[model samples]
Target: MAAILAAGAGLHPARNAAAAPMPRVAAAGWAGAQTLLALGVVPLALPEIARYRALVAEPPLPESVQELGLRSEPNLELLTALAPHLIVADAGSVTSPLARIAPVATFAPLRPGRRPAEAAREATLALAARLGRDAEAQSLIAAHEARLAGAAERLSGDRGGPLCLVSDAFGNRALVFGGNSLYQDVLDRVGLRNAFTGATSAWGHATVGLDQLAALDPTTRLVLLTSRVPDARTFLALRPLWRTLPFLREERVTVLADILFYGGLPSADRFARLLAERLAPGNAARG
Candidate 1:
């Protein structure tokens, strides 16, 4: 049985004689939830599960975990009610508020120059250690790596294919993702070249008009990360530059479901698999 201790916040949940290693966890961020799920632990509570579903569908959240409200300003009363052993949250304003409820451990989102995939692996391992789920973490990491390697092997020949990843945020504008992003890491792992080699914000994206995308080689394959907001269909339809794009004209465009580009290994694996299935040779008839 783990001894009771007043570790900083308040009372750490005391372990029973036969208690499970991490009986109950409540993650205040989606990445934390994803990592916990990757370790085979269904969190007791999740932050914005419905919204998370729309963005990152894979490694789905089980119905059992309660919703903790908005990611930015989580409901403190609800979080306190969950009585989590640890609250895994993003490092930001949310942390201070959540810490009042339970022991808070934070993971930095979009750290500059850190490959999201690598950061995810480290975060998973670190979280696993904290929860005494090291073995599960190893298995999850191995599986993630295997999936990435398989995708890489299948798309090996597509290395030279100039690629551009865009998030359709507005009708006439897009956020170009590249440079130290998990998507870029996944792209490199899957042997695709990112055509947006210019500077990017710390989050690894640059908001540009649709016309700016055409600056890349005409043969470049454009992939859009889609979401509900700024509807991809409506945006593409309204944007004149989208119609004039060579890739769009030649049918070389691929649209991938919106994923948590900053999520843990599972998200990276999911991204890689999507790219491989859509862009791999013989997978799709490309012009």
Candidate 2:
């Protein structure tokens, strides 16, 4: 299946063409950078470098990768100065300015109605082909499949815990992920049940009030998702009620990596594996 997808996607020919000589590449989003890294190709410029701190943790950025600016809006002058051979941006940023700077390729990490893991795989395979690393891309897909299979096997026995995947940044307002979102994908893969699986927006952010959350009640486990927001101390200080909630009291509140849920590449499988390990019955006690 992967071979057919790879061949149909034309990854091999594209990768071979790219490998004739190394080309300077600029990545404009977190997911694009991840795809480049997965292909064993480092971007000359990355706009959102800071958000990757939690993602990259202990390992330092390779010298080949340069910080350009925030992903929301990059420094055009700096990007122009880098003289990138190829500019990779998201669908939102594939503007004339970016195109004028260099040959721009727009890839979306999460398209409305598309599954996150499928998007990740497509993005990785596409980038690998474009960068001349088809073999590496194929290997990545295989590894992802194996990891996902293992996670599924480990989580197969779960009888479906009541789950709430929330993007809890502000105090009162929260966005719940459901429907076709990555959060839904992760929860499904881990054998957990989402309490809110009704209608969801294409962006995967559904604004819900505290009253709505409280109504979901004690039995439902809550997963808080944040991207390096307020310092941990400040966040804890502000949301004391969160810790006092019945779900938290029962130790059902789990904090997951926001980047993996939002800006993941083909590595969404890794996030599933981690969740399976963390949420699997008795596995937490064993650890």
Index of the highest-TM-score prediction: 1
lDDT digits (tens) for residues 1-287 of candidate 1 = 01111143432233331355554678888877887888888888887889888887778988998988788878789878777768888644356677777787675535655667766767776666667677888999889889989998988766445888887646667789877777888877777788888778877788887667777886798777776434334545766567777777766677777888777687788889888887777775432
Per-residue alpha-carbon lDDT of candidate 2 for residues 1-287, written as tens digits (9 for 90 to 100): 23212222212346267546766788886666666776777788886576565663212347667888777778899999998877777656645777778776676667765677777677667767667777888997787677777887887776645877776646766778776777677667656778776577765668876677777745887666554443334445677755555565566666655544455444465467557766766674211
- lDDT winner: 1
Task: Give each model's whole-structure lDDT.
Answer: 0.73, 0.65
Pairs of residues clashing in candidate 1: none
- Model 1 poorest ten-residue lDDT run: 1-10
Superposition-based RMSD of candidate 1 using all C-alpha atoms, in angstroms:
4.4
RMSD of each: 4.4, 4.8
For model 1, what is the alpha-carbon lDDT of residue 14?
A: 30
